[model samples]
Target chain A: MEYRKIKDEDEDGAGAGADIEGLRGKAFSSSAVSNMPPVERSKWKRKTIVTLALTVLTSSQAVLIVWSKRAGKYEYSVTTANFLVETLKCALSLAALARIWKNEGVTDDNRLSTTLDEVSVYPIPAALYLVKNLLQYYIFAYVDAPGYQILKNLNIISTGVLYRIILKKKLSEVQWAAFILLCAGCTTAQLNSRSDHVLQTPFQGWMMAIVMALLSGFAGVYTEAIIKKRPSRNINVQNFWLYVFGMAFNAVAIIIQDFDAVMNKGFFHGYSLITVLMILNHALSGIAVSMVMKYADNIVKVYSTSVAMLLTAVASVFLFGFHLSLAFFLGATVVSVSVYLHSVGKLQR
Target chain B: MEYRKIKDEDEDGAGAGADIEGLRGKAFSSSAVSNMPPVERSKWKRKTIVTLALTVLTSSQAVLIVWSKRAGKYEYSVTTANFLVETLKCALSLAALARIWKNEGVTDDNRLSTTLDEVSVYPIPAALYLVKNLLQYYIFAYVDAPGYQILKNLNIISTGVLYRIILKKKLSEVQWAAFILLCAGCTTAQLNSRSDHVLQTPFQGWMMAIVMALLSGFAGVYTEAIIKKRPSRNINVQNFWLYVFGMAFNAVAIIIQDFDAVMNKGFFHGYSLITVLMILNHALSGIAVSMVMKYADNIVKVYSTSVAMLLTAVASVFLFGFHLSLAFFLGATVVSVSVYLHSVGKLQR
Candidate 1:
């Protein structure tokens, strides 16, 4: 990620001499608002928009997913539903790529990346994510929902470790501190009210959660790195490849776990309005994850999910009669601080 | 505080010109280990020592105070003990100032200030401290200890605000985030297990806590500003004046709260080894606070006291069989991160 940033600075140095003449021409007309050039301001504004959009979309997706799961158990097979979500996400990415290609002309990496090596890389994360998602369902049998919510925060820590190891990114000491606080805050936010909680997590459940977190973190950081490897590549192209592989992996899972059920009742067995919404939510969230990985990083994705967790907890207070605990309040406060420290601290000179 | 640092840099520039000859002489002898000058390394080492010492001392004082009151009441009169602690602290400061004077000779600020204006400034914080300390006793009557513990964290936020307002210090957005996280973490760490919590804080208690927090914050920041106001002032001399005023104010409080008790019995009525030890601890902690405020700022004092809160809680778990809750663990993690970010993140650039 920083490598690409450095390249931009190099390009800026080369471009500044040529742009000087145009800058002088515009100075007369735009002198009143001259602190930052309009182009730079617009770029910053666009980045902010993207980050905010992703945060809102991801947070709403969390609420929707919980609402859909309000029925104690899913009426549909998890395997088939996951496959459909992947398929829809794949289609969305292709549609996006098609629009961009038409407007900007074809690019080498954006149009499915013609290189064999690049094509092979997408399957790695797809397989990891597939295993992680599958494990998510099995782990629920061993650990209760609240316990799992707390365990899920392990991903924040894992993501930071993998980002450092795989991306060779050197986070400042302060950023690492921010990352730890984010993880702790998210975990604290997930704490169930005393009366609602049970301390019955099995040893196996702990092991499974660790595995799931590692898989999720690795897949996320790997996806981010590959998309950013070719910074000029269209994000839709990367998302398309990722979802295509994701569909293939989920298809394999379905064949193993739900083949007979799907064959007997069709793919939309136990379908409902809520189920369709769930599929749509998952698909859009998948697309948002890819866009965030491409434009932002694993850190931003972690921050969004953490804030999302807090928002979900807040929604639960009103919608599901969840008690608003002091733990949750303090946790939310810490998370807010972590977000501010991360975005501004690292950037402050 | 920053003004003093700027002056030091200016001195370094002039000294460096004269020191170049000495640097060349040392270059030959210290060429093997020359990344940093030994003098610079020693200065950094001394700073680390001071910070660590203050942290340990403050944390120990918290634990000891709690332990001394394990029987649930102070047998000794609060007013007289506070007065005695203040007297001891003043004597300690005077002794320190005398030692410095004997060694390096008396400087204007290193001894009692000849300026009446400077002597007059000390009583403001002393009076504020007096009210805050006296309120500490009254607050317990309204709020449970745990609830009061949570409310006490408001001082961290208030101190940050006053530090900025009084010192004209512009904290980066990240530092503000760190302060918030520190406040939240301390509050979380103080969360009593559900079985132990009363959740019965009255409106009056809440109001009193807020007022106490503001008073404590203002007194601390005001003291820091004055101590750092004359950057060359001997810390011991400044501490001496503050403590003398503090002793005088506590004497007034003693006259009101303990005059009858003292007249009937003695000034040391109901005293024990624990009470005497507690007074000594309070005195040393007071002196340490002033040293920290002068060398550091209200922020450092807040951090020290916060970490001290966590340490005291951890000690309670082992010593008093306090049940260790997940809330405490998560809170400690957040506090640790806030410390790291406040120390390293803002300094990273």
Candidate 2:
């Protein structure tokens, strides 16, 4: 499925370029009637709404997932379950689309037919997604949430590289600089001045985090390229196929992990309400992340996630009775500046 | 969005009839090439694959969710988290669609424009989804997994009623009989011959289960109506709006439940790796349920779920040392018969 989308990209790139130009021209013409102010305002408004939604959803996902695990004190390995959950998430998207089609009386048989035809195009990305999620679960085993937050920023750089190579989209020098500043900001913001806690984290965890970051970068870029390949296709239609493959991939993962145990004992032996809630949180965050990727770029996703981490830290001060250090404030400032620069760079480009 | 779909159904019924007729003619003309053999064989093959997939995914979801809760031993209320999870599911669907658009070079500018224009349509269904999910969490709290599974069969009847009234779709007499048999089978199968377990469940749990069934029925029918109304719209585009509203609705639910603790303490506390796994499980189930709904209908979804419950029961015999009563086998026989009858009826129709 992934290969098909990439192939589609190669075949369709010229058409897409022409379409983008046409869209730009349309935007220019529309400026005469609407002027830039209202349109820009609405565009910004939409972006803000999307960004904030992503931030809140993702942060909540991280927090709730961690908290649920703590509350459950479960001893089971999470990798297989994670794969299963990823698969389920895809199924849910497909279901949602079906529901929409049934209720809305919108008949585009062509689109539906095309969607099914394209089902063969999603397996690669879905497999990549499964691997990335599995690695993420492993990373949680080693790194504290705060450390994980900081290390994940490495994806921004990886995404930049992937973006250039895969999409052949050039980043301006300023944009490149912004990427560096974004990384620096995230590192500063998540810096733990507390020596004891810092030393407690295993070196293996850090290594895992870096690898996870690299994986995330590749996955994010790959997903973006797939979406870009068929920019005009119904997003939901494409998602349906992507998720179909994802579910299949995860099923294999679960079966391979321990077929006998999963089949005989059941996949959810020691689960609780908290565990269910945690799964829910992860699913939501997945959606939020995908949305950010769709409307913006991987860089924007990274920035929004960073902002979420910042919010989480501030939130911790009151919720957990943690005291903020001076270094924390300094990091927050630098990160904020970097975010502003990145946004400005995006606008200028 | 729900209302729009419903309205569209009313408006487009004639057009749909014509389209169906047109399609039938096409099918008739194509029949000369191979008669029924190849076509029938392929159709049956597809159906078998889909049904098997649905059964496996749904069953795993049920077992894992129940097991996760049991393992956690946590006593916290799941209402707020349920809302958050529900919201997140929608967001995830949206994100998936967006990612697809980004990857696939399909650019329908009008589709994007129309998607935004239709944003106001999703809140009603989104809210309905929220309510149904919340009720489900409560049902889980009161009812044990096995009991929850059996009682949920009530939705089969409710769905039939709702389908007739909302979607104006009629069930064959055989289909209705199948529904009745399905309910009876589920009850008989779950009936505890063991006195100790039999007396333990509260009446309130039964009542909650009933309500959850009704809600499920309504939500399922309503969603089907919405989707049927807009068969032509991009499922992902529509999903994006639906999720946007769903997130908003969940945000309200979270705030109304307890604004201060959620906001100050943040949503995640006492979380661990296991909790994350459990969340992943729920998300996967959600997807599976959706997929079943999309590919088949509510009847198929109910049947698949029932099969999952039976699998879970059998698994418990091996994993949890539970004994399967003779009555369970008898009930299973009846349910299987009903499923076969329903499938035949659908084919005849």
Candidate 3:
């Protein structure tokens, strides 16, 4: 749900004067935030922070997966990791909700009833999340980190399309053009040099990446639509249910994959502490993605992912001793230009 | 900041009619939420869901950790895990911010300026978080999972005291009593039988747990005070800075611990996939804790933690083959009563 709607409804429902007076005593204590005009503190700062967080976290996850594959010590199935990640994320979201309840004191009895009533709507998005997560692992297997990074940019275009169709949110012509440029820039940046035929990626990997982009795009847009539909609801609360269903879906997948392997080996079989860190990174990235979707939109998420890909490439240079090609710099420059154009276009609108 | 204030200010700043018309088109399209009064949605449902989620996740983390310790494969130092967890969490928070930006379209030039303006205020809380997280590892080392669960309840009292002293918010008599009962119930629930003293716990563990509680109490309450001080600020934005400082602190700590070893062994030294999951679980739980503190009061967080402890205990029975004590049942009953009493007290107030 949009943050503004929740704030507006709270004022209307509680009576603005009384609410303000109450908040003034509690919120306007001796702190830097108390003296500022409310308008100056824009919600965009929060969204940007979340998006950046997601990018960094997800990039780390990507790096870890690539590193693990290179190490060849990680023998767990992708589905197993996905299951673990989903379960962990679901639990984490719930914990976040509890903290929110304790600190904000915003939720009351009536809200609880409505949340129960709305339980039916969560399964769809949760299912989509499960599918997307599973696809992500598969995609990782098919392509190298840099290749996956570039190809995944397809989500930007797909997300734009989905935003228009599912959320019925029209994109400006400039926005559409920017998306195309983003895709082209990402592809160019990750393209292998013709002389270096050392690492040829399979065609199936490219196909899987494209399908992943599509699934993620639709899922992201659909989630946004659901959340926006109830602007007055707590985003974290809705997220808790979304993760719950996601966990359920993953649980079934894990069972189908092999209950004995999971049971006998335990969740950490053949896993070292580094693997745990990667999973944690993955889980946090998941939370970050949802936060972005809830607060901003799929387009912003795509940009963040693009930025993350660049960061990942840079990190690989230092960590893996990988060389960056000239094409990469050219791609980076194009992506920067496109991002600038999109921002300017948005401002004008 | 509290979510409600942002909405009220937006209405006043942008003009109510234009904003509502704009929202109506985007938020009201064929969704179930359009027909209902915003007030009916309430916040409790979200709070309850989050709390439940936290309980499940935290419990699982506890169980996994205990299992790992028993497995003897977790050779990596707790400090290493702590460092990785902090960094990962920081990145995740940023990613979440990015997603928020994509969805909300709230950031503009002015908002960017204000966000930059507010950067200086985050370091204190961020440092506090680093301290608290490090202290948690120390606490975990000293105490068993169940013992840690019981003694950690002390934070409820400390949090209440800090909330009053720092935030200048008064607590009702019933709320105070509920807190007392909560601590008592948690203590009693996890009390071990003298005859079954198979695991000899040291007095140092208890001391460390109490110290950890005090730090957490102060950190939780102070963070709340800062957040409340600016009701119009975005929580995710604030979280970003807090995490940034935390990451910085952890970096310094890692260097101090032994830079060469970390670099040589790599951060994943002796770690398996399970270790990665544990770290992921820990990071998410940390986010959950902060979220609880941000959205609700520390008291509710205490309650949520207590519930999580119970869930952990229950899970241990199945997974770890631990027997549930009669005292555990009694403690659960008492906790339930206190929860009911607290809810009723809140309603009356």
Error of 2 at B109 (Å): 71
User: What ranking emerges by lDDT with the best candidate at the front?
Assistant: 1, 3, 2
- The window of 10 residues in a row where model 1 chain A has the poorest summed lDDT is A9-18
Off by over 4 Å in 2: A1-46, A69-72, A80-84, A103-110, A115-117, A132-150, A193-211, A258-265, B1-349
* Listed models, DockQ each: 0.38, 0.01, 0.01
Indicate the docking level reached by candidate 3: incorrect
TM agreement with the true structure for every prediction: 0.77, 0.41, 0.42
Per-residue lDDT of candidate 1, residues A84-137 (tens digit): 877898888888878888898886766765689877798988788667766766
**In the order shown, what is each candidate's alpha-carbon RMSD?**
10.2, 31.4, 29.0
Report the C-alpha lDDT of model 2 over A1-349, residue by residue, as the tens digit. Answer: 1111101111101010011112222443445334557767565444455556667765665455445544654544354545545655666677777787777755553155554445555676666655765565566667665555556556767777877887688775435654664555455445443322433568888677666666666767777666657655656666656556655776776666557776776777666775566556555556555555555556566666666767777776776666654334434654554454443344445
> iRMS values in order, in angstroms?
3.8, 29.7, 29.7
Report the lDDT tens digits of candidate 3 across residue range B1-349. 1111101111101100111111222344325334436663334334444555566666777677667766765666445766677677778876776777777865641132345546776666656645655565565555555555455556767777877887787765445655665565566565553312212447777677666666667766776666566655666666656666766776776786547778887776777776788778777766766665555555666666676777778888889898765445545655554555455444335
